[model samples]
Target: MARRTHKGEDDGTTSNNRLELIIEAAARMFDAKGYSATSTQDIANEVGLLKGSIYYYINSKEDLLFRIIEESHEGALRAIATVSHLDVGPLAKSYALVTTHVKVFHDDRVKHSVFFKEFRSLSDNRKEIIRGTGHAYSLFLRSILEEGQQVGQVDKALNPRMATAGIVGMLNSMSFWYQDGGSWGPENIGSQFAEQVVLGLVSEEYLLSSGGRKVLLETIRGELA
Candidate 1:
């Protein structure tokens, strides 16, 4: 038999909804005020609950921060998983990764702001877990670059690790300055970033080749479509 929550529905569904509300509230507070400066009362107030009520969903403020960070990374991990399995070349895969990443940040700007700004507030053990996830995401990008190199699509002399770091850094920075109602929306920003990545990293010879140009054009069109 399913356990009933205070709200009278199944425990699982109600609990999940409450947890999401708490996390969303916490994310906004953490993004506006630094993690150390925000209190459980503030989070509870944000969600219209008693201070102690938050304890039902999370043990501590640090736990809330950890959950927010984890949620942000989980979005990226899911995007990577989806793109990794696609039957496309490195350029298309790379474009998809960029667009997906940008969309995630755009969709949850407050959560991602907390993710970037308050991650170091986590305990050592929790920090390690976040680091592991981040490193795996980085390796995914590196693998795509490596594949591009092998196929003569990317610049042979470019360092995959460095390239990955640079691209990731650029994408993550979007959380800082991207406006929700700005003229350039997530898709536009993503496509432009993808174009920059391809144009910057692809071989000069490939860029000049008629066949290579056609392939790149088709890849961008397919992603936009």
Candidate 2:
């Protein structure tokens, strides 16, 4: 049997189907045309609605931009939050981070790409909101590195904060080029990325051993201590 999202009429919010369709269309158009090149009318046409009707669901084009970026960041935050309080150490936190982050991009290619690529197109105020969300997400990633450094698990030569930003920058770029149903799905890419990052931060001995269990344990302990 088909499940129903609405059991009755007059639910405070309309069915997500309409809003989702609009967002999905906006994501594709923005990705294809660049945010500046894509207009509310374009989104409206794509979704078979009058331009004004878009306002019924969202305030304006900028509002849509905010929604897209906010939603994307929120998704990433949820993933990060999952591991934020985990009993595992920083190294394992990082592994889980990569896995979850990559999965978000793979799950919603269009929305993820917009957040990665078109966020700057938002108005200044909207950009600030997005930036705040982005900063919060970055902090979680940085904390892992900082903890790793403390534990002697990660190399002291690296700056935890800067390294976190760099790794995120690298992974965020994945959405720009990653193809769905490609040879590498989110899981494979996440695993590969996790391995690459762990190697870069941990001792060469750990890198050589493949599983890197020893180095990971050391890193976490150092961080916890």
lDDT, model 1, position 103: 90
Query: How large an RMSD does model 2 have?
Result: 6.4
User: Each prediction's Cα lDDT score?
Assistant: 0.84, 0.76
Pull out the clashing pairs in model 2.
151-222, 151-223, 153-219
Model 2, 1-225: lDDT tens digits are: 743333222243554787888888887888788888899999988877777766667777877777777888888888878879778766678877887789887777778788778776777887887788788889888888889888766778888888898789878889767888889888889878876777678745444553456655456445544
For model 1, how many clashes? 0
lDDT against true structure, model 1: 0.84
What residue runs in model 1 are displaced by over 4 Å at the alpha carbon? 1-13, 211-215
Error of 1 at 218 (Å): 3.7
How well does candidate 1 score on lDDT at residue 118? Answer: 86
For model 1, residues 128-199, the per-residue Cα lDDT tens digits are 999999999999999999999998878999999999999999999997888889999998998899878887
Highest lDDT: give the candidate number.
Answer: 1
Top candidate on TM-score is 1
